[model samples]
Target: MPTVALHHESIRLHTPLPTAFGEIRERDLLIFELTGADGVTGRGEAAPLTPYDGVPLDVCAEALAVYASILQSYDDDAPGVLMLDACREAADIPVALAAVDLALWDRAGRRAGRPVASLLTDEPLDAVPVNATIGAVDRQSAASAAAAARDAGYSCIKLKVGVGDDAGRVAAVRAAAGPQMLLRLDANGAWDVEQAVRAIEVLSPAGLEFVEEPVHGLQALRAVRERVAARVSMDETAEDMGALIAGGADAVCLKISRCGGIAGLLAQAALVRSGGAEVYVASTFDGPLGIAAGVHVAAALRVQAACGLATLEALDIDVPEALRVRGGMIRVPTGPGLGV
Candidate 1:
């Protein structure tokens, strides 16, 4: 699986998915074709479960344009290697490179007659917990969305924040979802350290599981961690192992697309989760391709906290899923590669 080709998709979503951290306007799909010497093609996507993580749709096309030449050198059997090389050269935007990398893996999976999960050397399908994410614009919306998730059989729910109504919004979601559900929030770097502290205090009494990036920047993040009630996890801030270690993050948020590939994301998970930092394998509102990648990584690891995998409830279509959640426990995708 050495060579590569590109494709695109237009997906219509229900509405803009919102949370304390960020919002998704819509998610376009991307395809990567990894061709073998025999001319088989494998397809994969790189979009996050949600459209946050700072990856604008236009940036992906730009990434393809810039790295077109270097990617052409590799043959089909080397889809993984070809993608790795591109990632090394185009380090600034791993999300774009992820499309190529996963597509290569998908192609290689086809060549080997296995799913993406089977091709991963590090994974054999470990079980994990999954939380359903509900995207709503305000507390009223949050509350309504939470009820829908509860009805859908999700045990835990995560809401987005970053705007001013943080406390009331959480209250609305919590009240609607009821007390039995575990709640999480994502702020999308909307507050300063001081404001983050005040905001968390307002909501923590309701029993939050954790908070994702209440403030922006690495330094400000650590400062807010000192002040807030909910434990802080790094999402947009921790792109790689170096950043994860350097940022002093208590929890490392692993999104497959943002990490560039499942293989690399698994590597970072080993370093961060094994070292006692909280590791959550989640997605960025990516298409099914990206969701499968994150599911593979999370499915392979032993994660305690329920993941943000619930974000997929909002996607227009489904990708490969490694596991499903029931009563809060996440199931591991059972198969050769990540095609579960």
Candidate 2:
């Protein structure tokens, strides 16, 4: 059996990130460290932003306490069995379960002396393409940020829409990023079905890669996706796999915490692809450990779409330099475990 320990930390963003949900200026993250009997330790992060994902930090903490107690008595050598047992304990709290899943995977990879991606897949990518996120909503600010991202060697950019003047900001960003660059928008389910259709139709001419969560619920997403020529991707509305497979959108956005960690992410990715939709990884302003875990998963999958993992730069805290985005790509950490 392994011992589990928990730590809490608060981090502030360099600037407030404005989205359709609300403004995020800071984050309280929970880190879980799992140490095997052999004295090897693995790390994971649970970042819950109530305004973003609606999961509270205290609730995750309480779940972790329950998981910690269960892990203390359970003895399983097989990684799969260990994960299943751990997940059963924190099944209700996916965010907290994510921490345990991550730690287990990290410990497994470290024990095997391989990177987590290699442990998941036989062919892991050396680097994964990533997208720069622009938080600015106004035309001038959005255009300026888009231009900066272009100058910084980003080939893809994601902007938050359904906030204010969606058309103006989209047009501004398109012009600044040039016609060749891939441009995507996230509405955070802020609009109604009619509003989402209208917004997507109005913004399609600017060459949108996709519109994410334009409206809440699978049925509404399907309605909007059916009417518009532009592609639609589900984010917050993707929790229901049964409804998601019913063909609401062209793609789905997944996060580490939301998916319950790498193992769950792999399962969801398969489900998304089996339903004939694309799956891409994103972050919820997670700390370095969480972001690193996302990178490894994306690398193993070799997803075509640029992932939304280039978000660590938004935080004021220092992360591993290796996790930094370069040339519009994130290089997979090559060391054992998460390598960060």
Q: Which candidate is the best by lDDT?
A: 2
For model 2, how does the per-residue alpha-carbon lDDT over 280-327 read when each residue is reduced to its tens digit? 999898898888899999999998799999988888877688898888
Q: Where is the poorest 10-residue window by lDDT in model 2?
A: 78-87
lDDT of 2: 0.87
CA RMSD (A), model 1:
3.3
Write out the backbone clash pairs for model 2: none
Report lDDT (CA) for all predictions. Answer: 0.69, 0.87
Give, for candidate 1, the lowest lDDT window spanning 10 residues: 319-328
Residue 26's lDDT in candidate 2: 92
Please give the RMSD of candidate 2 to the true structure: 1.3
